[model samples]
Target: MLIMANNFFKPVGSKIFIINFYTFSKIENLIVWVNRSRYKNLDKIKYPAKAVIIDFSKCKPNIKPYHITPLACIIHEYQSKGYVIKLKNIPNNIECYLSSFNFQQFTENGSMIDIPVSSDCKILPLWLIKRNTYNLYPNRAKEYFENNHFDGLSLWPLSISLAELMNNIFDHSDSPIPGYTFTQYNATQDSIITCVCDFGVGIPVKVNNYLQTNNRGKLTNTGALLKAFEMNFSTKSQPHNKGYGLDNIISNIKLLNSKALIISNNVVYRIFPDNIEYTSELTVNFPGSLFVIWLNVNNLSVKEEEFADEAPL
Candidate 1:
Protein backbone atom coordinates (compact mmCIF):
# COMPACT_ATOMS: atom_id res chain seq x y z
CA MET A 1 0.00 0.00 0.00
CA LEU A 2 1.50 3.32 -1.14
CA ILE A 3 0.86 6.12 1.27
CA MET A 4 1.38 9.80 0.62
CA ALA A 5 4.34 11.10 2.57
CA ASN A 6 2.52 14.34 3.27
CA ASN A 7 0.09 16.87 1.90
CA PHE A 8 1.88 18.48 -1.03
CA PHE A 9 0.59 20.36 -4.03
CA LYS A 10 2.57 22.22 -6.66
CA PRO A 11 1.12 25.33 -8.25
CA VAL A 12 1.87 24.82 -11.91
CA GLY A 13 1.03 28.21 -13.28
CA SER A 14 -2.70 28.19 -12.42
CA LYS A 15 -2.89 24.39 -12.22
CA ILE A 16 -2.21 22.16 -9.25
CA PHE A 17 0.16 19.20 -9.45
CA ILE A 18 0.30 16.86 -6.47
CA ILE A 19 3.85 16.32 -5.26
CA ASN A 20 3.25 14.22 -2.16
CA PHE A 21 1.11 11.13 -2.33
CA TYR A 22 -0.31 11.66 1.18
CA THR A 23 -3.70 12.41 -0.39
CA PHE A 24 -3.18 10.03 -3.30
CA SER A 25 -5.03 7.27 -1.51
CA LYS A 26 -7.96 9.52 -0.62
CA ILE A 27 -8.27 10.53 -4.24
CA GLU A 28 -11.53 8.67 -4.64
CA ASN A 29 -12.36 10.78 -7.67
CA LEU A 30 -9.01 11.69 -9.13
CA ILE A 31 -9.96 14.94 -10.74
CA VAL A 32 -7.24 16.51 -12.87
CA TRP A 33 -7.85 20.17 -13.33
CA VAL A 34 -5.57 22.20 -15.58
CA ASN A 35 -5.55 25.86 -16.44
CA ARG A 36 -2.99 28.03 -18.19
CA SER A 37 -0.02 26.96 -16.10
CA ARG A 38 3.11 29.08 -15.99
CA TYR A 39 4.61 26.62 -18.42
CA LYS A 40 1.96 25.12 -20.65
CA ASN A 41 4.49 22.42 -21.39
CA LEU A 42 4.30 19.79 -18.62
CA ASP A 43 7.75 18.44 -19.51
CA LYS A 44 9.26 21.74 -18.46
CA ILE A 45 7.87 21.14 -14.99
CA LYS A 46 8.92 18.41 -12.58
CA TYR A 47 7.00 15.83 -10.60
CA PRO A 48 7.97 13.79 -7.54
CA ALA A 49 6.17 10.51 -7.97
CA LYS A 50 6.04 7.65 -10.47
CA ALA A 51 2.29 7.25 -10.98
CA VAL A 52 -0.33 9.96 -11.59
CA ILE A 53 -4.13 9.91 -11.48
CA ILE A 54 -6.72 11.61 -13.64
CA ASP A 55 -10.46 11.96 -13.24
CA PHE A 56 -11.86 12.85 -16.62
CA SER A 57 -15.51 12.49 -15.67
CA LYS A 58 -15.95 16.10 -16.62
CA CYS A 59 -13.25 16.55 -19.27
CA LYS A 60 -14.69 18.46 -22.19
CA PRO A 61 -14.70 16.43 -25.38
CA ASN A 62 -12.33 19.09 -26.63
CA ILE A 63 -9.80 20.45 -24.21
CA LYS A 64 -7.49 23.18 -25.33
CA PRO A 65 -4.15 24.30 -23.96
CA TYR A 66 -3.08 20.68 -23.46
CA HIS A 67 0.24 19.07 -24.37
CA ILE A 68 -0.32 15.51 -25.61
CA THR A 69 3.11 14.06 -26.38
CA PRO A 70 4.69 15.34 -23.20
CA LEU A 71 1.87 13.87 -21.16
CA ALA A 72 2.22 10.60 -23.04
CA CYS A 73 5.91 10.53 -22.26
CA ILE A 74 5.10 11.07 -18.60
CA ILE A 75 2.73 8.12 -18.64
CA HIS A 76 5.43 5.98 -20.21
CA GLU A 77 7.79 7.00 -17.44
CA TYR A 78 5.34 5.79 -14.84
CA GLN A 79 4.60 2.64 -16.80
CA SER A 80 8.25 1.61 -16.45
CA LYS A 81 7.69 1.47 -12.71
CA GLY A 82 4.57 -0.64 -13.06
CA TYR A 83 2.77 2.15 -11.35
CA VAL A 84 -0.98 2.09 -10.91
CA ILE A 85 -2.78 4.67 -13.03
CA LYS A 86 -6.15 4.96 -11.35
CA LEU A 87 -8.87 6.64 -13.28
CA LYS A 88 -12.33 7.75 -12.18
CA ASN A 89 -13.58 8.87 -15.56
CA ILE A 90 -12.29 7.67 -18.91
CA PRO A 91 -12.95 9.14 -22.34
CA ASN A 92 -13.12 7.19 -25.59
CA ASN A 93 -10.41 9.14 -27.37
CA ILE A 94 -8.25 8.99 -24.30
CA GLU A 95 -8.70 5.20 -24.19
CA CYS A 96 -7.31 4.93 -27.70
CA TYR A 97 -4.23 6.78 -26.63
CA LEU A 98 -3.49 4.53 -23.68
CA SER A 99 -4.09 1.42 -25.76
CA SER A 100 -1.30 2.59 -28.08
CA PHE A 101 0.98 1.37 -25.32
CA ASN A 102 0.11 -1.26 -22.70
CA PHE A 103 -1.49 -1.10 -19.28
CA GLN A 104 -3.00 -3.52 -16.80
CA GLN A 105 -5.38 -2.82 -13.95
CA PHE A 106 -3.88 -0.52 -11.38
CA THR A 107 -3.67 -1.19 -7.65
CA GLU A 108 -6.89 0.79 -7.57
CA ASN A 109 -9.70 -0.13 -9.89
CA GLY A 110 -10.11 0.96 -13.53
CA SER A 111 -7.73 0.73 -16.51
CA MET A 112 -8.46 2.69 -19.63
CA ILE A 113 -6.60 2.05 -22.88
CA ASP A 114 -7.10 5.60 -24.08
CA ILE A 115 -4.18 8.00 -23.93
CA PRO A 116 -4.42 10.66 -21.23
CA VAL A 117 -5.23 13.73 -23.29
CA SER A 118 -7.05 14.15 -26.57
CA SER A 119 -5.75 16.39 -29.35
CA ASP A 120 -6.95 17.36 -32.83
CA CYS A 121 -3.42 17.29 -34.14
CA LYS A 122 -3.09 15.05 -37.23
CA ILE A 123 0.52 14.49 -36.26
CA LEU A 124 -0.63 12.17 -33.46
CA PRO A 125 -1.04 8.82 -35.23
CA LEU A 126 1.69 9.55 -37.77
CA TRP A 127 4.22 10.33 -35.08
CA LEU A 128 3.00 8.32 -32.09
CA ILE A 129 2.90 4.75 -33.37
CA LYS A 130 3.36 2.42 -30.37
CA ARG A 131 6.69 0.59 -30.06
CA ASN A 132 7.13 -2.65 -32.04
CA THR A 133 3.88 -2.06 -33.87
CA TYR A 134 4.27 -4.24 -36.95
CA ASN A 135 7.78 -3.12 -37.85
CA LEU A 136 6.42 -0.08 -39.66
CA TYR A 137 9.66 1.92 -39.55
CA PRO A 138 10.46 1.15 -43.17
CA ASN A 139 7.00 2.05 -44.36
CA ARG A 140 6.91 5.18 -42.22
CA ALA A 141 10.19 6.48 -43.65
CA LYS A 142 9.14 5.67 -47.19
CA GLU A 143 5.86 7.51 -46.73
CA TYR A 144 7.50 10.66 -45.42
CA PHE A 145 10.40 10.73 -47.88
CA GLU A 146 8.44 9.80 -50.98
CA ASN A 147 5.58 12.16 -50.23
CA ASN A 148 8.05 15.01 -50.12
CA HIS A 149 9.95 13.68 -53.16
CA PHE A 150 13.18 13.62 -51.13
CA ASP A 151 16.30 12.19 -52.72
CA GLY A 152 16.98 8.50 -52.33
CA LEU A 153 19.93 9.26 -50.06
CA SER A 154 17.42 10.86 -47.73
CA LEU A 155 15.34 7.68 -47.79
CA TRP A 156 18.35 5.51 -47.06
CA PRO A 157 19.35 7.26 -43.87
CA LEU A 158 15.79 7.95 -42.83
CA SER A 159 14.91 4.30 -43.13
CA ILE A 160 18.15 3.00 -41.67
CA SER A 161 18.50 5.60 -38.95
CA LEU A 162 14.85 5.40 -37.95
CA ALA A 163 15.13 1.64 -37.58
CA GLU A 164 18.25 2.05 -35.52
CA LEU A 165 16.51 4.65 -33.42
CA MET A 166 13.63 2.26 -32.67
CA ASN A 167 16.09 -0.56 -32.07
CA ASN A 168 17.93 1.55 -29.53
CA ILE A 169 14.73 2.04 -27.61
CA PHE A 170 14.28 -1.73 -27.44
CA ASP A 171 17.98 -2.30 -26.85
CA HIS A 172 18.58 0.30 -24.14
CA SER A 173 15.22 1.54 -22.92
CA ASP A 174 14.24 -0.86 -20.19
CA SER A 175 10.62 0.23 -20.40
CA PRO A 176 7.97 -2.06 -21.84
CA ILE A 177 6.17 0.90 -23.39
CA PRO A 178 7.00 1.27 -27.07
CA GLY A 179 9.10 4.18 -28.23
CA TYR A 180 7.31 6.95 -30.12
CA THR A 181 8.60 8.41 -33.39
CA PHE A 182 7.57 11.83 -34.65
CA THR A 183 8.26 13.51 -37.99
CA GLN A 184 7.27 16.96 -39.13
CA TYR A 185 8.01 18.03 -42.68
CA ASN A 186 8.49 21.74 -42.35
CA ALA A 187 8.14 23.21 -45.81
CA THR A 188 9.26 26.61 -44.68
CA GLN A 189 12.43 25.15 -43.21
CA ASP A 190 12.65 22.68 -46.11
CA SER A 191 13.65 19.92 -43.77
CA ILE A 192 12.20 16.79 -42.26
CA ILE A 193 12.07 17.32 -38.51
CA THR A 194 12.18 13.90 -36.90
CA CYS A 195 12.14 12.91 -33.24
CA VAL A 196 12.12 9.50 -31.56
CA CYS A 197 11.30 9.46 -27.85
CA ASP A 198 11.00 6.97 -24.98
CA PHE A 199 10.92 7.17 -21.20
CA GLY A 200 13.41 4.47 -20.32
CA VAL A 201 16.98 3.98 -19.18
CA GLY A 202 18.58 6.95 -20.93
CA ILE A 203 21.74 6.93 -23.05
CA PRO A 204 24.14 8.08 -20.32
CA VAL A 205 23.67 4.92 -18.25
CA LYS A 206 24.50 2.65 -21.19
CA VAL A 207 27.43 4.75 -22.40
CA ASN A 208 28.90 5.03 -18.93
CA ASN A 209 28.76 1.26 -18.52
CA TYR A 210 30.70 0.78 -21.73
CA LEU A 211 33.22 3.38 -20.57
CA GLN A 212 33.69 1.56 -17.28
CA THR A 213 34.51 -1.66 -19.15
CA ASN A 214 36.92 0.09 -21.55
CA ASN A 215 38.87 1.75 -18.65
CA ARG A 216 37.62 5.20 -19.63
CA GLY A 217 36.78 7.41 -16.67
CA LYS A 218 33.08 7.69 -16.00
CA LEU A 219 31.63 10.28 -18.37
CA THR A 220 29.00 12.88 -17.79
CA ASN A 221 25.76 12.33 -19.74
CA THR A 222 26.93 14.98 -22.19
CA GLY A 223 30.28 13.29 -22.69
CA ALA A 224 28.59 9.97 -23.33
CA LEU A 225 26.25 11.60 -25.86
CA LEU A 226 29.06 13.32 -27.73
CA LYS A 227 31.01 10.07 -27.81
CA ALA A 228 28.03 8.13 -29.20
CA PHE A 229 28.32 9.89 -32.56
CA GLU A 230 31.83 8.65 -33.16
CA MET A 231 32.17 5.50 -35.28
CA ASN A 232 32.26 2.03 -33.62
CA PHE A 233 31.08 3.16 -30.17
CA SER A 234 28.19 1.13 -28.76
CA THR A 235 26.81 -0.23 -25.50
CA LYS A 236 25.24 -3.34 -27.00
CA SER A 237 26.97 -6.59 -25.95
CA GLN A 238 25.71 -8.53 -28.96
CA PRO A 239 28.27 -9.35 -31.62
CA HIS A 240 26.25 -7.63 -34.36
CA ASN A 241 25.74 -4.44 -32.37
CA LYS A 242 28.23 -2.51 -34.53
CA GLY A 243 27.09 0.85 -33.10
CA TYR A 244 26.80 2.04 -36.67
CA GLY A 245 23.24 3.39 -36.89
CA LEU A 246 23.64 6.83 -35.32
CA ASP A 247 27.05 7.35 -36.90
CA ASN A 248 25.36 6.68 -40.21
CA ILE A 249 22.80 9.31 -39.27
CA ILE A 250 25.70 11.69 -38.75
CA SER A 251 27.20 10.81 -42.12
CA ASN A 252 23.88 11.36 -43.89
CA ILE A 253 23.26 14.58 -41.99
CA LYS A 254 26.56 15.94 -43.28
CA LEU A 255 26.05 14.65 -46.81
CA LEU A 256 22.70 16.44 -46.91
CA ASN A 257 23.95 19.52 -45.07
CA SER A 258 21.56 18.85 -42.21
CA LYS A 259 21.64 18.58 -38.42
CA ALA A 260 21.04 16.05 -35.64
CA LEU A 261 20.65 16.43 -31.89
CA ILE A 262 20.43 13.74 -29.18
CA ILE A 263 19.27 14.51 -25.64
CA SER A 264 19.53 12.04 -22.79
CA ASN A 265 19.59 12.36 -19.01
CA ASN A 266 20.91 15.89 -18.55
CA VAL A 267 23.11 16.09 -21.64
CA VAL A 268 22.39 17.34 -25.13
CA TYR A 269 24.50 16.67 -28.23
CA ARG A 270 24.18 18.42 -31.57
CA ILE A 271 25.80 17.85 -34.96
CA PHE A 272 25.61 20.76 -37.37
CA PRO A 273 26.73 20.86 -40.96
CA ASP A 274 29.97 22.47 -39.86
CA ASN A 275 30.58 20.94 -36.41
CA ILE A 276 29.42 18.70 -33.57
CA GLU A 277 28.85 20.03 -30.04
CA TYR A 278 27.33 19.04 -26.70
CA THR A 279 26.05 20.55 -23.44
CA SER A 280 25.81 18.97 -20.01
CA GLU A 281 23.57 19.19 -16.93
CA LEU A 282 20.54 20.89 -18.37
CA THR A 283 18.08 22.66 -16.09
CA VAL A 284 16.08 19.43 -15.89
CA ASN A 285 16.95 15.77 -16.32
CA PHE A 286 14.88 14.19 -19.06
CA PRO A 287 13.57 10.83 -17.85
CA GLY A 288 14.67 9.21 -21.10
CA SER A 289 16.24 10.05 -24.46
CA LEU A 290 14.98 12.14 -27.34
CA PHE A 291 16.78 11.82 -30.67
CA VAL A 292 16.07 14.61 -33.18
CA ILE A 293 17.37 14.78 -36.74
CA TRP A 294 16.88 17.52 -39.30
CA LEU A 295 17.32 16.47 -42.89
CA ASN A 296 17.50 19.57 -45.02
CA VAL A 297 15.99 18.64 -48.36
CA ASN A 298 16.15 22.12 -49.84
CA ASN A 299 18.12 20.92 -52.86
CA LEU A 300 18.93 17.26 -52.31
CA SER A 301 19.69 15.21 -55.46
CA VAL A 302 21.30 11.92 -54.39
CA LYS A 303 19.86 8.73 -55.96
CA GLU A 304 18.88 5.43 -54.32
CA GLU A 305 21.43 3.42 -56.35
CA GLU A 306 24.19 5.60 -54.94
CA PHE A 307 23.58 4.28 -51.39
CA ALA A 308 24.02 0.56 -52.14
CA ASP A 309 27.12 0.22 -50.00
CA GLU A 310 25.30 1.32 -46.81
CA ALA A 311 24.96 -1.43 -44.17
CA PRO A 312 21.65 -3.09 -43.35
CA LEU A 313 19.60 -1.48 -40.64
Candidate 2:
Protein backbone atom coordinates (compact mmCIF):
# COMPACT_ATOMS: atom_id res chain seq x y z
CA MET A 1 0.00 0.00 0.00
CA LEU A 2 1.31 3.43 -0.93
CA ILE A 3 0.27 6.89 0.28
CA MET A 4 1.61 9.51 -2.12
CA ALA A 5 1.67 13.29 -2.25
CA ASN A 6 1.26 15.01 -5.67
CA ASN A 7 2.01 18.66 -6.44
CA PHE A 8 0.48 19.48 -9.84
CA PHE A 9 1.48 23.17 -9.73
CA LYS A 10 5.11 22.26 -9.03
CA PRO A 11 5.72 18.71 -10.34
CA VAL A 12 9.42 18.92 -9.47
CA GLY A 13 8.76 19.87 -5.80
CA SER A 14 9.38 17.45 -2.89
CA LYS A 15 7.09 14.41 -2.56
CA ILE A 16 6.64 11.75 0.16
CA PHE A 17 5.26 8.21 -0.09
CA ILE A 18 4.59 5.88 2.86
CA ILE A 19 4.40 2.21 1.84
CA ASN A 20 3.34 -0.84 3.86
CA PHE A 21 2.59 -4.52 3.16
CA TYR A 22 -0.78 -4.42 4.97
CA THR A 23 -3.67 -2.65 3.23
CA PHE A 24 -5.27 0.41 4.82
CA SER A 25 -8.16 0.87 2.37
CA LYS A 26 -10.44 2.68 4.84
CA ILE A 27 -7.69 5.08 5.91
CA GLU A 28 -6.90 5.75 2.27
CA ASN A 29 -10.56 6.49 1.59
CA LEU A 30 -10.66 8.94 4.52
CA ILE A 31 -7.54 10.69 3.25
CA VAL A 32 -9.11 11.00 -0.28
CA TRP A 33 -12.28 12.40 1.21
CA VAL A 34 -10.29 14.96 3.26
CA ASN A 35 -8.22 15.96 0.20
CA ARG A 36 -11.33 16.69 -1.82
CA SER A 37 -12.39 19.25 0.81
CA ARG A 38 -9.91 21.09 3.08
CA TYR A 39 -6.64 19.80 1.55
CA LYS A 40 -7.46 20.54 -2.08
CA ASN A 41 -3.98 21.99 -2.64
CA LEU A 42 -1.16 19.39 -2.66
CA ASP A 43 1.23 21.87 -0.96
CA LYS A 44 -0.83 21.74 2.19
CA ILE A 45 0.74 18.45 3.35
CA LYS A 46 4.20 18.72 4.91
CA TYR A 47 6.64 15.98 3.84
CA PRO A 48 9.38 14.69 6.13
CA ALA A 49 12.92 14.63 4.62
CA LYS A 50 13.76 11.10 5.90
CA ALA A 51 12.22 7.62 5.95
CA VAL A 52 13.06 4.50 8.06
CA ILE A 53 12.68 0.79 7.16
CA ILE A 54 12.39 -2.02 9.75
CA ASP A 55 12.82 -5.62 8.48
CA PHE A 56 11.61 -8.52 10.62
CA SER A 57 11.45 -11.51 8.26
CA LYS A 58 14.54 -13.11 9.85
CA CYS A 59 13.49 -12.55 13.48
CA LYS A 60 12.46 -15.49 15.70
CA PRO A 61 8.75 -16.23 15.97
CA ASN A 62 8.93 -16.15 19.77
CA ILE A 63 10.74 -12.80 19.90
CA LYS A 64 8.85 -9.79 21.19
CA PRO A 65 7.73 -7.01 18.89
CA TYR A 66 10.03 -3.99 18.53
CA HIS A 67 8.93 -0.83 20.35
CA ILE A 68 8.33 2.14 18.05
CA THR A 69 9.11 5.07 20.37
CA PRO A 70 12.88 4.42 20.27
CA LEU A 71 12.65 3.92 16.53
CA ALA A 72 10.91 7.31 16.16
CA CYS A 73 13.67 8.93 18.20
CA ILE A 74 16.26 7.24 16.01
CA ILE A 75 14.57 8.58 12.91
CA HIS A 76 14.67 12.09 14.31
CA GLU A 77 18.36 11.70 15.10
CA TYR A 78 19.15 10.44 11.58
CA GLN A 79 17.15 13.26 10.03
CA SER A 80 19.71 15.64 11.59
CA LYS A 81 22.39 13.72 9.63
CA GLY A 82 20.65 14.35 6.26
CA TYR A 83 19.60 10.70 5.72
CA VAL A 84 16.18 9.09 5.09
CA ILE A 85 15.07 5.73 6.55
CA LYS A 86 12.66 3.11 5.20
CA LEU A 87 11.22 0.27 7.36
CA LYS A 88 10.32 -2.84 5.39
CA ASN A 89 9.34 -6.53 5.79
CA ILE A 90 8.26 -6.50 9.46
CA PRO A 91 7.46 -10.10 10.48
CA ASN A 92 3.82 -10.74 11.45
CA ASN A 93 4.96 -13.27 14.11
CA ILE A 94 6.89 -10.59 16.06
CA GLU A 95 3.77 -8.44 16.36
CA CYS A 96 1.74 -11.42 17.51
CA TYR A 97 4.30 -12.36 20.16
CA LEU A 98 4.43 -8.82 21.52
CA SER A 99 0.66 -8.61 21.65
CA SER A 100 0.52 -11.85 23.65
CA PHE A 101 2.93 -10.60 26.33
CA ASN A 102 2.23 -7.53 28.42
CA PHE A 103 4.94 -5.29 29.86
CA GLN A 104 4.51 -6.61 33.41
CA GLN A 105 4.65 -10.21 32.25
CA PHE A 106 7.86 -9.60 30.31
CA THR A 107 9.51 -7.89 33.26
CA GLU A 108 8.48 -10.52 35.80
CA ASN A 109 9.05 -13.69 33.81
CA GLY A 110 12.29 -12.89 32.01
CA SER A 111 15.13 -15.32 32.66
CA MET A 112 17.91 -14.20 35.06
CA ILE A 113 21.20 -15.93 34.46
CA ASP A 114 23.00 -17.69 37.31
CA ILE A 115 26.19 -16.32 38.90
CA PRO A 116 29.08 -18.30 40.37
CA VAL A 117 29.57 -18.15 44.13
CA SER A 118 32.06 -19.93 46.35
CA SER A 119 31.40 -22.49 49.05
CA ASP A 120 33.06 -20.19 51.58
CA CYS A 121 30.92 -17.24 50.37
CA LYS A 122 33.94 -15.51 48.82
CA ILE A 123 33.91 -15.11 45.04
CA LEU A 124 37.09 -16.65 43.65
CA PRO A 125 39.25 -15.09 40.94
CA LEU A 126 38.54 -11.43 41.60
CA TRP A 127 38.67 -10.77 37.83
CA LEU A 128 35.49 -12.84 37.41
CA ILE A 129 33.58 -11.17 40.24
CA LYS A 130 31.88 -8.10 38.77
CA ARG A 131 28.64 -6.47 40.00
CA ASN A 132 26.65 -6.76 36.75
CA THR A 133 28.74 -9.28 34.82
CA TYR A 134 27.58 -12.28 36.85
CA ASN A 135 24.10 -12.18 38.33
CA LEU A 136 24.60 -8.67 39.73
CA TYR A 137 25.96 -9.66 43.12
CA PRO A 138 26.18 -6.11 44.51
CA ASN A 139 22.66 -5.14 43.52
CA ARG A 140 21.34 -8.58 44.43
CA ALA A 141 22.72 -8.13 47.94
CA LYS A 142 21.13 -4.70 48.13
CA GLU A 143 17.74 -6.06 47.04
CA TYR A 144 17.97 -8.89 49.55
CA PHE A 145 18.51 -6.44 52.39
CA GLU A 146 15.72 -4.24 51.06
CA ASN A 147 13.26 -7.14 50.88
CA ASN A 148 14.15 -8.20 54.41
CA HIS A 149 13.29 -4.62 55.43
CA PHE A 150 16.63 -3.85 57.04
CA ASP A 151 18.61 -0.62 57.11
CA GLY A 152 20.77 0.08 54.02
CA LEU A 153 24.05 0.05 55.99
CA SER A 154 24.23 -3.75 56.28
CA LEU A 155 25.40 -4.24 52.71
CA TRP A 156 28.03 -1.51 52.37
CA PRO A 157 30.67 -3.02 54.70
CA LEU A 158 30.55 -6.38 52.98
CA SER A 159 30.78 -4.68 49.60
CA ILE A 160 33.83 -2.68 50.70
CA SER A 161 35.44 -5.78 52.19
CA LEU A 162 34.93 -7.72 49.00
CA ALA A 163 36.37 -4.90 46.92
CA GLU A 164 39.45 -4.68 49.17
CA LEU A 165 40.08 -8.43 49.01
CA MET A 166 39.69 -8.53 45.23
CA ASN A 167 41.90 -5.51 44.78
CA ASN A 168 44.64 -7.14 46.86
CA ILE A 169 44.48 -10.31 44.80
CA PHE A 170 45.00 -8.35 41.59
CA ASP A 171 47.60 -5.84 42.84
CA HIS A 172 49.72 -8.01 45.17
CA SER A 173 49.88 -11.27 43.26
CA ASP A 174 52.74 -11.47 40.74
CA SER A 175 51.24 -12.54 37.43
CA PRO A 176 52.79 -14.81 34.70
CA ILE A 177 52.49 -17.29 37.54
CA PRO A 178 49.03 -18.86 37.96
CA GLY A 179 47.00 -16.62 40.28
CA TYR A 180 45.01 -17.35 43.44
CA THR A 181 41.74 -19.27 43.91
CA PHE A 182 38.83 -17.75 45.90
CA THR A 183 36.01 -19.47 47.78
CA GLN A 184 33.32 -18.50 50.25
CA TYR A 185 30.87 -20.12 52.67
CA ASN A 186 28.51 -19.17 55.45
CA ALA A 187 29.94 -19.61 58.93
CA THR A 188 28.25 -19.83 62.32
CA GLN A 189 24.74 -18.38 62.26
CA ASP A 190 25.41 -14.79 61.30
CA SER A 191 28.71 -14.66 59.42
CA ILE A 192 29.74 -15.00 55.76
CA ILE A 193 33.31 -16.27 55.34
CA THR A 194 35.62 -16.05 52.32
CA CYS A 195 39.11 -17.32 51.52
CA VAL A 196 41.68 -16.48 48.86
CA CYS A 197 44.49 -18.94 48.18
CA ASP A 198 47.51 -18.28 46.04
CA PHE A 199 50.08 -20.88 44.96
CA GLY A 200 52.76 -18.38 44.06
CA VAL A 201 55.79 -17.64 46.29
CA GLY A 202 54.44 -17.03 49.80
CA ILE A 203 54.49 -13.65 51.57
CA PRO A 204 57.05 -14.92 54.06
CA VAL A 205 59.54 -15.80 51.34
CA LYS A 206 59.25 -12.32 49.83
CA VAL A 207 59.65 -10.64 53.22
CA ASN A 208 62.54 -12.88 54.18
CA ASN A 209 64.39 -11.92 51.01
CA TYR A 210 63.79 -8.26 51.74
CA LEU A 211 65.04 -8.59 55.32
CA GLN A 212 68.05 -10.66 54.32
CA THR A 213 69.26 -7.87 52.04
CA ASN A 214 68.91 -5.42 54.94
CA ASN A 215 71.22 -7.68 57.05
CA ARG A 216 68.26 -8.87 59.21
CA GLY A 217 68.90 -12.46 57.96
CA LYS A 218 66.34 -15.06 56.84
CA LEU A 219 62.87 -14.86 58.49
CA THR A 220 60.11 -17.49 58.46
CA ASN A 221 56.86 -16.94 56.46
CA THR A 222 54.88 -16.80 59.67
CA GLY A 223 57.20 -14.06 60.87
CA ALA A 224 56.89 -12.37 57.49
CA LEU A 225 53.04 -12.31 57.47
CA LEU A 226 53.11 -10.74 60.94
CA LYS A 227 55.81 -8.26 60.04
CA ALA A 228 53.98 -7.51 56.79
CA PHE A 229 51.50 -5.47 58.84
CA GLU A 230 54.27 -3.48 60.52
CA MET A 231 54.37 0.10 59.27
CA ASN A 232 57.20 0.82 56.79
CA PHE A 233 58.40 -2.80 56.58
CA SER A 234 58.47 -3.29 52.82
CA THR A 235 60.42 -5.34 50.29
CA LYS A 236 61.21 -2.37 48.08
CA SER A 237 63.92 -0.03 49.34
CA GLN A 238 64.24 3.76 49.10
CA PRO A 239 61.35 5.44 47.20
CA HIS A 240 60.33 2.21 45.51
CA ASN A 241 57.99 1.00 48.27
CA LYS A 242 55.67 3.10 50.37
CA GLY A 243 54.97 0.04 52.60
CA TYR A 244 51.35 1.09 53.21
CA GLY A 245 49.16 -1.43 51.34
CA LEU A 246 49.18 -4.30 53.85
CA ASP A 247 49.32 -1.88 56.79
CA ASN A 248 46.24 -0.10 55.46
CA ILE A 249 44.50 -3.45 55.14
CA ILE A 250 45.25 -4.21 58.78
CA SER A 251 43.99 -0.77 59.82
CA ASN A 252 40.76 -1.14 57.84
CA ILE A 253 40.06 -4.49 59.49
CA LYS A 254 39.41 -2.59 62.71
CA LEU A 255 37.23 -0.03 60.92
CA LEU A 256 35.17 -2.74 59.21
CA ASN A 257 35.16 -4.79 62.48
CA SER A 258 36.22 -7.93 60.62
CA LYS A 259 38.37 -10.98 61.35
CA ALA A 260 41.17 -12.30 59.15
CA LEU A 261 43.63 -15.21 59.13
CA ILE A 262 46.78 -15.45 57.04
CA ILE A 263 48.55 -18.80 56.65
CA SER A 264 51.95 -18.85 54.97
CA ASN A 265 55.16 -20.88 55.24
CA ASN A 266 53.72 -23.08 57.98
CA VAL A 267 52.72 -20.09 60.13
CA VAL A 268 49.35 -18.51 60.88
CA TYR A 269 48.63 -14.90 61.85
CA ARG A 270 45.09 -14.64 63.14
CA ILE A 271 43.51 -11.25 63.82
CA PHE A 272 40.25 -11.12 65.71
CA PRO A 273 38.43 -8.14 67.18
CA ASP A 274 40.93 -7.29 69.90
CA ASN A 275 44.13 -9.33 69.99
CA ILE A 276 46.39 -10.35 67.08
CA GLU A 277 47.95 -13.77 67.61
CA TYR A 278 50.51 -15.84 65.71
CA THR A 279 51.07 -19.59 65.49
CA SER A 280 54.02 -21.53 64.05
CA GLU A 281 52.12 -24.50 62.67
CA LEU A 282 51.92 -24.19 58.89
CA THR A 283 48.57 -25.56 57.68
CA VAL A 284 49.07 -24.73 53.98
CA ASN A 285 50.27 -27.70 51.94
CA PHE A 286 51.58 -25.53 49.08
CA PRO A 287 54.12 -22.68 48.79
CA GLY A 288 51.54 -19.89 48.55
CA SER A 289 49.47 -17.84 51.00
CA LEU A 290 45.84 -18.17 52.12
CA PHE A 291 43.76 -15.34 53.56
CA VAL A 292 40.46 -16.20 55.20
CA ILE A 293 38.14 -13.34 56.20
CA TRP A 294 34.95 -13.57 58.25
CA LEU A 295 32.32 -10.85 57.90
CA ASN A 296 29.41 -10.34 60.32
CA VAL A 297 26.63 -9.53 57.89
CA ASN A 298 23.82 -9.52 60.43
CA ASN A 299 25.20 -6.94 62.87
CA LEU A 300 27.41 -4.60 60.86
CA SER A 301 28.23 -2.01 63.50
CA VAL A 302 31.44 -0.09 62.79
CA LYS A 303 31.73 0.90 66.43
CA GLU A 304 34.32 -1.14 68.28
CA GLU A 305 32.75 -3.51 70.71
CA GLU A 306 34.69 -5.12 73.56
CA PHE A 307 37.15 -7.55 71.97
CA ALA A 308 35.66 -11.02 71.86
CA ASP A 309 36.35 -12.92 75.12
CA GLU A 310 37.65 -15.84 73.06
CA ALA A 311 40.67 -13.87 71.78
CA PRO A 312 43.89 -14.96 73.49
CA LEU A 313 44.85 -12.44 76.19
Best-matching candidate per lDDT = 1
Residues 31-149, model 2: lDDT tens digits: 22222212112233454434323344433453211122112222333343444445445566555433332212222221221343222112221213323342344345434443343
Q: Output the lDDT of residue 175, model 1.
A: 47
lDDT of each: 0.53, 0.43
Q: Write the per-residue lDDT of candidate 1 for residues 1-313, one digit (tens) a residue.
A: 1122111233444322332211121111111211111122344345444445654554444321113333445445455455545554557875554344322232232223323221322222324445435257546655545654553544566677776777677766664456566555556677776777766668887788878998989977776776776787667734435647467677877877888867677676777876555464664555567777887776466554546687898
Off by over 4 Å in 1: 1-68, 76-131, 148-154, 213-216, 237-243, 276-278, 305-313
Q: What is the C-alpha RMSD of each candidate to the true structure, in Å?
A: 10.5, 24.0
Model 1: how far residue 41 lies from native, Å: 17
Which ranges of candidate 2 are over 4 A from the true structure?
Answer: 1-151, 154-164, 167-172, 175-188, 213-216, 236-243, 255-257, 283-285, 302-313
Model 1 accuracy (lDDT, Cα): 0.53
